[model samples]
Target: MAEGILRPLGSSDLRLSPLGLGCWQFSKGRGLVGKFWPVLEDSVIRDIVRTSWEGGINWFDTAEAYGGGQSEEMLADALSALGEAGRGAHVATKWWPIMRTAGNIGKTIDERLRRLKGWPIDLYQVHQPYSFSSAASEMHAMAKLVQQGRIKHVGVSNFTADKMAEADKALREHGLRLVSNQVKYSLLDRRIERNGIMEAAKELGVAIIAYSPLEQGILSGKFHSNPELVKQISGPRKWSSGFKPEALNRTRPLIDRLNELADKYGASPSQVSLNWLIHAHGETVFAIPGASKPHHAQENVNAMRFTLSQEEIGELAELADRSKR
Candidate 1:
């Protein structure tokens, strides 16, 4: 029964689930890759998407850079399986800033549309500010699409406050506004708070779609130990004793606290971390935690099943602050 929590996305007319399933992991495909840096198969991916919808998640985030469009294709694949309800799912996708040419933008959007197979993307965003030229050109292209109704709204990711303001101002010139900036934010990384991205987003009426919201799984408590877990769960890292061990020790206590809290609430560590994010920023903030399994998807959906108290939120914030230093 973890449904009915809808938050306004800044000034946009749209609303989203507190926790949306990210489609980035679908690039790995199934098998050994699925186990170690896994991606679900089409069949399983379909089930997971549907299960997420059943679990009350109405939003999904994907990018063209993920698996060379495999993520979008898989999202489209999942939509083909959902029938009517799938059509209503809010989708947020990105265009690489480097691919900013009008022709290239058309091609990229077409490619994404082909993969999505006509699901009607609710939000389309620029992946990042790759360069000044690409950034400026892509902003215009996004505006053109908004005018043509190919995309519902415009967004940008990995943008700083200055770039966000620039992009917003640029789009506003065309009678449009960038709706969100997807970035890496979690207990481990709060750079947005210092960099003015959060405050600027508040000022500009743009939401922040926090990717890697779990810190590449570091904040999820799964990477608390063993060099192999990092490699197996995260990705291959060059072997170095000093590096891995240090990261482990620093993160261990946080994970321990997360585990303790998880047990008390009967929630997984990932859920706790995401819940913390929800409590940290309220509704304008959303987390997109990817999964390669139905159960993991289920656990992520369970994130909104409980609420943390103000005192607990404060304690976690203090712990995160200490861990940062």
Candidate 2:
């Protein structure tokens, strides 16, 4: 259960473990997005949370769009059942913007709280940059939530460098600061590095929460080792370009390096991938890998047990960069 030091989530007072439990997979088969995962029984949910909690993970990330609050409710139920709620267990949930405007940020605060069963929303994020309202407007609405003690801090997801600036500026106007930006970051998906998001986050002191850090299990090296395994993968990931035979061939070197390091450290390829993610960018990057089962949760925790050397980190980065080209 040993792990790395806790890092700041941004300008917020919350110090988080290197990884958090991504609760999107706990969607319980409800909403549109929830259909991606199978409905987990309450006992299974409890085991996942308990394993993660006992492994030293202090926080969790879920979304309002995830099963339309089914994830939040179930996560809350799991934590409460395990006696971890309100006991250093921070919960972060997002507001689904999509066609909605900033008004909905306030309108739905109670529903979020209602589903959480009075659990404080440690960090509330605007689900995406495509909201009907501007980033400034969304941040302003989130600031109001902070003032009312509805939420502890504000964040955004899938935002560009410029949009992150707008949200930060809006929060600073109200004497608050944008805490984090959750994005689709992984070894295979390094668009944020080439794009301006990484630079802007560092300059603005915003934390980058890397979601899908394992690249939807591609970095786990299972698909590459056993090509036939792809057929068993449910949901849209099988259709993703990364799961294709050629893409697997393309990323073979990076996965090979990950596997080598996994063997060297006595860990799994997914753990090596997750370790590199949280360490490669210093404290600026944190990851939230999903866990459908207790063993997956334990693997996520083990990822924290070892630190990839700087040389190994650079080696993997170079391999990833080459694979992309």
Candidate 3:
């Protein structure tokens, strides 16, 4: 572990390396307007997970909704492989909030645990706040898992500030507290800061897990000069409003500056992007950047070893602040 980089997930026993491996992309293909379809095969995913573990990514995240349970199976394979190699990695997964009824809460936990194949899941989260029917019952079920040692801690994802507080209050009734909130917080997406999500999490001592910390590779200088490549990678969603060419245009200056700084630091654009997040965001804040290639995985692991200067952090933040998207 790199000294001074590991940070505790507020109030939880779990300590995550600054850069975690986001396994969602291994199973879910990418697209510009939206994500691509037809998830990767089990063997391909297993290889991705193994590479991630070997690259010092001790923290891996997945969700039950990913590839309709295939993601969990893939995670299990990686966990088993890591255990065999004596790596003993940590895993975090999520439960879709649509299945929050009392009758299904306990069963859902059991099914997720079963798919994990006895590897202790460090964190289990509610994927979204789709519904809150029997919130008490659902929280209690999670509490029961902690008691049974099936899950180490509880968390929430894509939750609003208000919903996060409510969940925390309800879980506390059962003597459980949510340790983190996994939200999309990056230079390109600052909605959390404006919407009070950041403030609430800080006040409640919940760690913010920043997914898409590279802004879907936008911050890595890949799409800076090539609008056509951006469109090609965006797939059918290219026509979607979210995949507009204007967004790519907005990122050019930041991309150029990132490249310049990356050269100075002897790192890739991806590493600079991750380092920028760590410095501009809180020390408790951690990012999970997805990588489909082995070299990409290696670059991500190397990102944790460096520090961004205060001046560079501010310059990058200002550059992003000026970006429209």
Best by lDDT: 2
**Best-performing candidate as measured by TM-score:** 2
In the range 1-325, model 2's lDDT, one tens digit per residue, is: 2344798998889999989999998898998899999888889999999899889898999999999999999999888876634377889999999899999999999999999986889999999898788999999999999999999999999999999999999999999998999999998889999899999999999999999898888999999999999999888777888888888899999989988999999999999999999999889998999999999999999998989999999999899999977
Candidate 1 C-alpha lDDT tens digits along 96-127: 65634544676667777787778787889878
TM-score of each: 0.89, 0.98, 0.89
Per-residue lDDT value at 74 in model 3:
72
Q: lDDT per residue, candidate 3, 59-165, as tens digits?
A: 88888777555667777875676556735678899887673564565678778888778767799887776755644455677888888887889888888898788
Distance from true location, Cα of 54 in model 3, Å: 3.1
- Pairwise TM-score winner, candidates 1 and 2: 2
* Candidate 1 structure, TM-score to reference: 0.89
Root-mean-square deviation of candidate 2? 1.3
Candidate 3 Cα deviation (angstroms), residue 195? 0.8
Q: What is the C-alpha RMSD of each candidate to the true structure, in Å?
A: 3.2, 1.3, 3.1
Where does model 1 exceed 4 Å of error?
28-36, 99-103, 132-136, 225-234, 237-243
